[model samples]
Target: MAADATKSTAGRTVFRHRLSTRAWHWLNALTVIVMLMSGLMIFNAHPRLYWGHAGANADPAWLEIGATPTEGILKVGALTLPTTGVLGRWTDRHGVVQTRAFPGWATIPTDYSLAGARRWHLAFAWVLVIGGALYGVASLINRHIQRDLAPSRGELAPRHIWRDIKDHARGRLPGGEAAARYNILQKLSYLAVIFGLLPLMVLSGLGMAPGVDAGWPWIVDLLGGRQSARSIHFLCATALLGFILVHLAMVVIAGPINEIRSMITGRYRLPAERA
Candidate 1:
């Protein structure tokens, strides 16, 4: 029995990453998290997206004023109010009853606090943008990006990509290849989110900032104007969010515990058997 246990442990394979890669991975995760939380808070500030006209256009139908912004504060109003008295009652120190607004067809409880949300969002934005740039430059210098992240020639083949997809779908990924890093789909996704989408979000966000047009007028021109930049920024944020959702789903499908451990430690244990 002891011999069998020892054999099992010996059969497992472990991989270690250099300190730079580990630091970059963790910091990237941290900044992305900060961006997500603060971005959601910021989105709550606007709470609306317009297409042709300002979201506040008088004749808008597909998008109506979901919340009335009064006193520089916005709320979600009737769209998300409690039904069936599930919110319960609150009592003041004086024993007076405090009630939640019961949402009806015409009225929903609105989300508010634009000023505070913007402050938090802008603050975290600085960290993400600066930190990401530094990480990118460092990765280039160390060749970590080229060596680890860039797809291999084998990964470029349609057959290899298809095989990875099938394995991902069927939960039958091979365990032997430690050098088998990210599959094509994963490489593409990481590239899009890290290189393309994130930079766009930061640039568009900065373009929409008040007085930015004075220093970088072309940014406004590139995005078609300040308002248009805001729209694009929001769209980019949505894309990043979608990627995060898909990533989480893949982790869950692949084996949540093991995947999470690999991310945290930068090492994954491979099973003994390989055909």
Candidate 2:
């Protein structure tokens, strides 16, 4: 009777995210949100980006957010765009004109306080680092990364990747058994985020910390310099933000309830097998 029940259940659902993965997923989500908002607030302190070892108001910046005699503008490279009310200048709820890189609504306290924002940012940075480390260990021990995220030889083929891209463009997702497994694109995305962007974010962030740099000057040197590290950190943050937006959109397109439930409960109801 137990065997029969197991077989019946297997026909409808599959174990997708593990308990550890689910926990890390939600926890990481919270920590990343806190980090992003607070980081933006920190950026408000210096709304400019530059390349090379050292940069200041005296030097040329690759990017700057400020207001001209006419209107607020965001200057990047050789282009300048009007960004009033979003980037350079905007009016607060009290009808007072304010100048900041990011608007108040987009920042963590929704007010201008770099000190308060740093506290929140640092606190969550620890959480992300510790949680990511544990998740990495668990993934290795459980062979979850190997079996699920690592692309197979066949999946690594260009044809396979192109097919996945076309399918995604056409809003066609895998069903049944295919749906239960990660596709080539999904595997690559997860690998990039986990191994590439996250590490860059952590290292570049440490590079910006005065205390961390004092202890490990090599970190800042490896990245080129303090200002360079700051620019790289901002770029990585922007990439991560893009990933999050795409991830949420894919979830909604693929079936938000089932996709979300799988992350929350570890049981995913597989779509009907395609003919």
Candidate 3:
């Protein structure tokens, strides 16, 4: 009886997150935060948006009537939506000047350091890119990507995807040995972040970097130009931020305590149904 009890308890397992995943996740989070904050400061320099303008023109409209921040132009494939925050500025004829403002929102004061903002932005960007590269290479070498991060062939089938969708819709998820491992949703999210959004972010950023034009003129040409690159960079950053929110929501829905513990301590107690 005792032996059976022991076996049952043992089978009621406590699955732990691999140390590498915990390290990579937190590092990615921190570096991305730094990049986002510094990027915002840098963006404050040119808070205006332009449909098309190589340089200034004599027309009043060409004078950039107001700053319309590109923060809300989120796009992936063909879908597009107005996101959050309309960055702008206003200067009253009476000589009162304001940095940023929206219809019913608060006004933000502007700073005068395009050079410094660019420097800080580029510096933090290096951390994000370098850290992400290291994490990717390390995951490859450690078999972390292959073992836990990739979705199974069967999981990629329409039936499995439909089931996952159904489960997700109902706020119920797969558990068992399957859930102990990352499900297809987790795998796809990781893949999209690492392969799709992250790389696009880095590339778009590099396209805007001044020195890059000398050697990689094609990058700038490919993305349009420096200003266009900046717009794309902002769009991708917003998408990544949205993904982070959904990721966190999933963790919470799954099990907040266990999820937080896994991230902090690299250990998660597998659900009861998981073996």
Candidate 4:
């Protein structure tokens, strides 16, 4: 695996992604999908979030997704919104009405099965943990983190970061040889998901487990409490979903052929710099 993307053949093509990176990426994609759908089904069992140490139906909920006889509503604090066709209420495949927070098509098993969803979610949770650990080791061994992900001091400056943000807002994507390497925004976003968000998600998840809470009490305390952990976990999952959507959009906008090829075959054709 090459530390940095290298150009050859008049610098038109570069070894963009390593085999390990490609493998982990695809595996992570599958794991995340299963985890998300199953988790959503689990959420359907209790479509409300609270704070502090304990929460119940009678407790004050910071967020709630439920249905009335007429329609479905999602409430965050005092703000409430109707979500009928997609969330909180929808028609099932059998033409039956569902009042779950998420639709059947969006959940694992495609039916209301908390036990089944937990089976899938817990099974994939191990994969996420083990696969992420292995990828971290591989990245360090290949210097992928240092060479590609680490931003230079100059790149970390406020002006430099602001410039990248402005460029993205203006749709001025990188091209030419510059396309081979990650820009500052890419590096920061990747780092956030890889290190900060993912790890926090795992810890918060562990806090939600009774056995883990009993044995490793500090894990729950570290996150304030079980209800707090649950809220954080939900927020983190939402953020990760947003990141995935933006990532897919970028892949489509930045030439899907080249972008998808790099992830699939570890080879990328560097786009020539824009005028």
Kindly indicate the candidate among 3 and 4 with the higher lDDT. Answer: 4
Task: Give candidate 4 regions above 4 Å deviation.
Answer: 1-11
Please give, for residues 34-83, the per-residue lDDT of candidate 1 as tens digits: 66655654554444544431345352323122322211212233244322
Tens digits of per-residue lDDT for model 3 on 1-275?
35544445433545557776788788888778767666665655544333222322332221121333433333333454453344344443344444432221211113445576567667767777778888888889989888887888898999998888888888886554445677888888889999999998998888876799789988878888776676678778879989989988998898898778877887555554422
> What CA root-mean-square deviation does each model show from the true structure?
7.5, 3.6, 6.4, 3.7
Colliding residue pairs in candidate 3? none
lDDT order, best first, reads 4, 2, 3, 1
For model 1, the run of ten residues with the poorest summed lDDT:
101-110
Q: Against the hidden reference, what TM-scores do the models get?
A: 0.71, 0.94, 0.75, 0.95
Give one digit per residue, the lDDT tens place, for model 2 in 122-234. Answer: 99999999999999999999999999999999999999999999999998988766788888888999999999999999999999888988999999999999999999999
Candidate 3: residue 236 Cα off by (Å): 0.6
Task: Give, for candidate 3, the lowest lDDT window spanning 10 residues.
Answer: 101-110
As a whole number from 0 to 100, the lDDT of residue 136 in candidate 2 is: 97
- Over 1-275, each residue of candidate 4 has an lDDT whose tens digit, in order, gives 13233323324878899988999999999999898889899999999999978999999999999998979899999999999978888999999998999999999979999999999999999999999999999999999999999999999999999999999888888876778899999999999999999899899999999999999999999999999999999999999999999999989888899899999999898775655
